[model samples]
Target: MTTRMNEYKQQIITDFNSRINYDNEFRYRFAKPLIELAQLKPGQRVLDVATGTGIVAIAAAKIVGDAGYVLGVDISTGMLAQAQRKVELEKLQNIELLEADADDLNFDDNSFDVIFCSAAIAYLTDVFTSLCQWYRFLNTGGIVAFSCFAETAHTASILFREKAQIYGITVPNPNATLGNPEKCQYLLQQVGFQNIKVVTQQFGFYLNDAESAWNANANSAYGYQVFQLPPDKLAQLKTEYIAEIHASSTEQGFWHDVNSLFVFARKS
Candidate 1:
């Protein structure tokens, strides 16, 4: 990997570690469908990539029971720390947590019956290499499943971008690639995954008000980029950005539309 790839990995790790205290019930809620889609069964070996807080990993461990095993790998120690706590709290002996990069997943050929990733594929620099690694590690009939933001996911950020452009502040959308169903399919196909299927889900995050919207934004990858903008532009951005967020709110609070895509495939 290049220096840039290393930087991306570090940035992602920092961001997620910083987010350990935020409202993350969604991560736990998301585990059920992700585990189900992977078709986890009793006594099957499972691997969970980016197992933040052990949501998916712990859930898989319960399903796999004592006769099976699950390995959860992540690049962030902060996340794994929380995951370890959860594992101990549950008294689960079937799962192991390790700090490792998804960029180079070193595992034996056909080692796992199921591999799962959730809501973290976009942070990866190259989807192809990760997908190929997944293919190699999965058993011949094993399944690989993951969830990602669709191209149209982050409406608040889109609104912020339009406002920022008015002030001559242009930054990259962190989710610019492999977000839509088409791109998701293309990447998996190129990596020789079979039975490729993508499920699109439309939802929204309920921010209590405009201030809450800004708070959420400030905690995101876009917020980090926005903070680095020139002072004058950043000031202008804050004004219009807040106004846009306020305008989108209602009695039910501000609703940020979340469009997500769930990608699943099998190693043939």
Candidate 2:
């Protein structure tokens, strides 16, 4: 990996590891839907990429029964440790958790019958290349399923970038590449995936206050660039971000759009 990419990966590892405990409930809520869409079956070999805490992996393990196997890989040791605990608690012999980068995985061609990545593909350094790799990892007619956020999702993030631009800072949107159904389908098509499907679901909710929303955005991977600002500048940015939240708030509270896109395709 290039120095920049290595640094980026390290940042991602640090960020996610810190979130291992607090984010599981939220992560599982979204992952449940993706797992249902996967339609896992008995005796199938599965790969769960970036499988934080193995929510999808464990669920797959249960549904696939004793004969099936799952290999869940992630870069965060802390997250994998938690996943291991869960697997052992359930005595699931069919699932294996590994500390590995999703972008650099090595496996023989046609190694898996189904591949899953829930709410994590957008974080890959090269999403298109990663999809191509997954295509190669799957058996012919095998399915690859994953999820991402819509470009217009996360209202706080959208407003944060808009306000940050006025301060001469340009924050990157990680979800930009796989942000929409069309983008998701186009990339899978380019990678030779057939029967591509993109399902949209709204997991959006109202945050009771600006502080709650600010805290979430400030701590997220998407907010890493903004978080790196100097103390003075970051304080000013936070002030402006809170003001934007207030301006956009409704009687119900600030509506944070968690519009998620669950994408599936076959390696035909």
Top lDDT prediction, candidate number: 2
TM-scores for candidates 1 onward, in order: 0.90, 0.94
Stretches of candidate 1 exceeding 4 Å from the true structure: 1-7, 22-24, 167-169
Cα lDDT tens digits, model 2, 1-268, are: 6875766787788777887454546777999888888899999999999998888999999999899999999999989988999999999999999989898998999999999998888888889889888989999999999999998998878888887777777767878999999999899999999999999999998877887677666666666567557899989988988987888888998898999999889998
Clash pairs (backbone) in predicted model 1: none
lDDT of 1 at 33: 66
Local distance difference test scores for all models: 0.79, 0.87
lDDT of 2 at 83: 90
lDDT of 1 by residue, 43-95 (tens): 99999998887788899999999999999998888889988988999999999
Off-target runs (Cα >4 Å) in candidate 2 are 23-25
